[model samples]
Target: MVSGTVLLLLTVLSVCGKAAAERKLVYVTVLFRHGDRSPVKAYPTDPYQENDWPQGFGQLSQEGMRQHFDLGQFLRNRYKGFLNESYDRHEISVRSTDYDRTLMSAEANLAGLYPPSGRQVFNPNLPWQPIPVHTVPQSEERLLSFPLGDCPRYKQLMNETEHTEEFLNVTKTYKDIIDLVRNKTGLNKTNVESVWSVYDTLFCESRHNMSAPDWVTPELMEKLRILKDFGFRVMFGVYKQQDKSRLQGGMLLGEIVKNLSTMADAESKKQLKFMMLSAHDTTVAALQASLNVFNGRQPPYASCQIFELYKDDNGSASVSMFYRNNSKADAYQLQLPGCALDCPLEDFVKITKLSISDDRDKECQLPSEGRDKEVIISLAVSGCLLIFLIALLLGVICWQKEPVSSRGYHHVINREVGEES
Candidate 1:
């Protein structure tokens, strides 16, 4: 009896171990904001201008390089067991926006994530190996960029958003600051949307230890920060957020969902282990907003959003998300709104489909009311043209039927006939 009991216990233990081992990490996709950089531009009348930056406006700083490199190291440590010890081009892919800052950030990050190993080392003295960071021209880039300008419906939605009660309240609350900034900055107009530039300028200057003007105080800066955060909300949320997402962030989300689904398939030959995206804070915010998981704050420099796909023993797949906004802390897991922390892959896809659009261009067309007005105008103009054409044709027929005696040409025709005879 004792021997039989021990055998049953061992069998149960072995099964539990096998079950645990069956849950394997299959694929990972990471989208991270580019590291710190100088202000994209300065407001009019600001002391710091484009020339003040080391590499002019919007260039990445050395500190930015360090931040990304550190983030790369963090990633290396986090995925030490899963990722190959050496950099394998086939295992990972990196893409960045065509901006110098984002490209440099990706390169810097790779320096940390994949330092030279044996054959990859071109020079013993130089530990870094070149890793290609792919990008497309800014004009052609749609994925990984937020609030794309080409979508007419998105623009219309934004215009409608301006009139929402929440938007109106925020605008009214910040009217004084808006007017003050307009006067101080020499701008002709400054509203809640445009005032964020002032805050960004000040925030960048503050980060670089530049002194603000006498009028710019701590209290005012705080208000500006709030406004800046609200500005992000305005871009991706605030009103009809899900519809706006379908036109904006959903584009990228759809691609991610596709990638996750592809990885979930057991027969998929895609051997890619990790896909890295280096983009701006707005990109991160846009994606989070589409997921209905945005925390209503700007994603800080080097903030990373991670998606991990895992396969279970029963051939079922699951997805998990994590956000690493702070350098010192571990990436905390983010649960989908309706699903658990480890959401089933199908459930995730179903929930996210609400934000994704089947045809972006079709969805971007003018709303029904606007389309109806345009159609009505078009039909009226076409009807008038048709009526005028019919009238012209009737007048020609009437002229042909006029009596020949009434026309002097009749006499001319008779004379010509006599001459011919």
Candidate 2:
């Protein structure tokens, strides 16, 4: 009897496992960096200038287009039946930063994702059809850009980060290398924050097989590479990573989580299936930092961070993340720090709460500096007093300048008497 009962329980457990495996994909959000591009800017002594590039500085190259196209094809294969075979504006949304390269990359990606078919085809000669990739002005781009310039709190955090023990140690250890870059690259400033620019320009030049300066030896290149990676960590990780993420990457992560949570509702399941965000490498790093799973290396060109939401037969939803940094390799599955690879939505949200900010503006406001607040108050009081005295002096001067009017009857009588005489 006991054996029969045990066999029945085993059969029930096998059925439950199968049901879990059949969870339906409810939604997906993908954030990817632009493909290869010309250097953003070159140092004063650099060999390659802006004019050397085909489209000048910061424009995406032909290889970049290919990278994004391949990414789109990969997405199409992954979401074969989940998404429509043709482009549907209602089902998917694409947002990109307001930069030429990112905008172009998004368009190229769309071409591979939704090749025109049947009525969707506008012209036979071209397989591509125009798809909207929306963007806001660069100044207002908080959704996809990291190390946001407008967040004063984030700036304060960065400033404090520079003073931390880890930061000081890094600076002290790499002092010689930093000095070499400053002197050789003709960069006015060379610190942990700015050293990455030199690395970036050199890395891009090397990729294009352009000759680098004699100073950039292989050993030097390796050191610059390490510093560049460290620069990324300093930007989004290193000290108080969660707080930094809340102010930088957490902003984007919060929106993505909200969207996923909304789609988890059965009523909203069909409303939207896919969301594509085209942004920078820093943006990807920030989000990964917030998730506490960043690999601490620079995200490569066309790198993609993907979030997939699935609902099991039991009506519970889970979120899964993947990072595709290399086109030649499979995307790495990222597990939320305290959860499984497929984390329950509730647990995911709870674990990520510390990184999300409800009021970004409030959080960005740094506490008043030690003595600066007193100085500001003193200056403000003095200025107010100065203004008050100036107004009083002006009032007196106006009164003194006015001519006193003679009494009407006395003035008229005196004038008449003088005329008669």
User: Which one wins on lDDT?
Assistant: 1
**What tens digits encode model 1's per-residue C-alpha lDDT throughout 96-215?**
999999999999999999988988889999989998899999999999878799988999999999999999999999899988899888989888887988898898889999889888
Q: Alpha-carbon error at 368 in model 1, in Å? A: 3.9
lDDT of model 1 at residue 263?
Answer: 90
lDDT of 2 by residue, 255-316 (tens): 99899889998677366899999989998899999889999999999999999999987789
Name the regions of candidate 2 deviating beyond 4 angstroms.
1-17, 369-421
Winning candidate number (TM-score): 1
Residue 322's lDDT in candidate 2: 94
TM-score of 1: 0.86
In TM-score terms, candidate 2 sits at: 0.85
